[model samples]
Target: MSNEFALNAEARSDLGKGASRRLRRNANLVPAVIYGGDKAPQSISLLAKDLAKLLENEAAFSHVLSLNVAGANETVLIKALQRHPAKGYVLHADFQRVVAGQKLQAHVPLHFMNQETAAGVKTGGGEISHTLSEVEVSCLPKDLPEFIEVDMAKVEVGQIVHLSDLKLPKGVELVALAHGSDLAVANIHMPRVQAESEDTGTAAE
Candidate 1:
C-alpha cells in the first residue's frame, strides 16, 4: 500500500475521559485507540494540527493509513470518530489494525457522475435526488477503494438507482446487499413544484 497518508503519535499512558480532556485542552492532542490483529489495544495521542490537516482530504477515511506510534509504524484503517457536537471537531478516534489477508468493512463515499447531463435532468426536466452519500463495503486491505462511482448519464426520470445497480470494483462487496437489502442509492424524479403545479392545473380545469 502507498504511504500517501501518515501520522506520528506518542504512546499515551494517560487514559480516561478526564485525561483525554486535559490532553486536548492543554496539549492540543487527540486521544485515540488502536486495536485488532494479534496485538492488544494500544492507546495513543496525535497532534491536533497534524490530524486536522490529514482529515482535510476526503480520501483519507477510506485509505489505509501509516501510523507511527513511538517510533513503531503500523498500518491501520480509521474505524470510528467521535466529534464535538457543537464545534464539529474530532475528539477521539478509533483505529483498526489492517491484516493482509483478512477482509474488513469500510464506508466509502459515492461520487455521482454526469448529474447535470443525465437524460432525466437534461431533456426530461427532472431533478436528481440522492439517497445515499456513501456505502459500506467489505473487502481485503489491498482491494479497498477510495470511493464508489455512481453513473447517472443514462438514468431516466422516475428510475431509482439501487445498490444492485452500482458497479463495484473487483474483490469488493456491499455489506447491505450481502444481508439481503438492496437499498436505493439515488433517483431522478420530477420536481415537487412541477408536480404541484400540474395538480393545481388539473383541479382548475
Candidate 2:
C-alpha cells in the first residue's frame, strides 16, 4: 500500500503500425494513450517491463499513478490494459488523466479475506463462489480506494453478496448500484451431502 511505481516517458508524435512496431523493436517501449475531461488524447510510450511488474499488483489498476510523460506530470488511473495473448506481455494501456476535483470512474480490485475458515465453509462445506473480482466505482481522485473489501465472515450458506452491500469510502459510489441489476457478487453453497440431506427431508414431507 505504501509503495508507488513511477515511470518516465515521452510524448509520441509518430503513430500507426509502422511507428509503433519500430518503437517496440528499437526501444522496447509500448505505445499508449492518455485522455480525459477537456484534454485531448495524447500518444505516449512506456517501458514494457515496468508495466508488467505494476500489473502484478491489483492495486495498480485503480490507484492514482504519477505519469511523467511529455514534459508534464499527470495524475491518472489505469482504464484498460491490452496484452499479447500468446506472449502474455503488455501491449498497450489506456489512462484517464484526472483533475484534482473531477469525479472519475476506476475499476477497483476486490479483496476477499477470512473466507477460507468461515463458518459456512468449515461447518457446512460451503463453496465460495465469486462473481466479480474488481468493481467499477466513481469518486474524486482523492477519494479513490485501494481496493474493495468483501467480508466473507458474515457470508452464510445460500447467502448472496451484492455490490450494494459493500462498505465504500465516503463519496465513492459503486457502479452496480446505479444499474439496479441483481448481479450475484458471490455465494456460499453447501456441499453435496448437505444438499442431498435437505432434498431428502423435503421428499419425506
Candidate 3:
C-alpha cells in the first residue's frame, strides 16, 4: 500500500501478432490488456521503457497500480507479463482491474526473517529450507499486502512452518488455506550432510 505506481498508455486499435511486433520493433511500445471487474477488456499499448521502469520495483507486482489509458484512469494490479525468452524484455503485459469492495486474489512474495538468528540455526546446527517463495492471498485491493513475513526466530530444528502458521495481515486470507490446503511454507532441519550421516549410522546399527 505504501508503494504507488502509475503508467501512461494509449488505446491501441491495431491487433494481432504482426501489429504487436511492429509496435515493439518500430515504436518501442508494449501491448497490454486490462480486464476484470464489470467492464469488457481494453486493448492498450504502453511505452516499453516506461513499463520496464515501473516493473523495476518488486512491489509493483502486488500493489494496486494507477494506469492512465488515453487520459482515463484505471486502478489495476499486474496479472501477468510475457517476456522475451532470452533477452528478457517485456513482450506483453496483462492487468486486472481492481473493483472496490470486491475480493481479489494475487500472489505476494514471502520474506523470511531472522534466518541467521533462528533457534534452529544458531543453536541446533540446522538449516532453513523454503518450500514456497510466494503465496496467493485473497483480499480487497485496498487490503493487499506487498509481502508477507515469515518469522523464524523461535523455530527449532524439525519444526515446519505451514501455510496456516503464517500471520496474515488484517483482512487478508490465504487462498490455499481457504481451500483446505495447509501447504508447507518453510522448515528448519538438520543439515543435509548431518542428516545423511545419522541415517547411515542408524542403518549400520
Candidate with the greatest TM-score versus the true structure: 1
Off by over 4 Å in 2: 1-3, 192-205
Residue 131's lDDT in candidate 2: 94
Shift in Å, residue 32, candidate 3: 0.5
Model 1 per-residue lDDT tens digits across residues 1-205: 4555899999999889999999999999999999999999999999999998989999999999999998999899999999999998899999999999999999999999999999999999999999999999999999999999999999999999999999999999999999999999999999999999999999999
TM-scores of the models, in the order given: 0.98, 0.89, 0.94
Which prediction has the highest lDDT against the true structure? 1
Model 2 lDDT tens row, 25-124: 8999989999986888999999877787777877788889888886688777788878889987877788888898988888888898889887678777
Ranking by TM-score: 1, 3, 2
Model 1 clash count equals 0
Task: Please report the TM-score between candidate 2 and the true structure.
Answer: 0.89
lDDT score for candidate 1 against the true structure: 0.95
Q: Write the per-residue lDDT of candidate 3 for residues 19-94, one digit (tens) a residue.
A: 9999999999999999999999999999999998888888898889999987899999999999999999999999
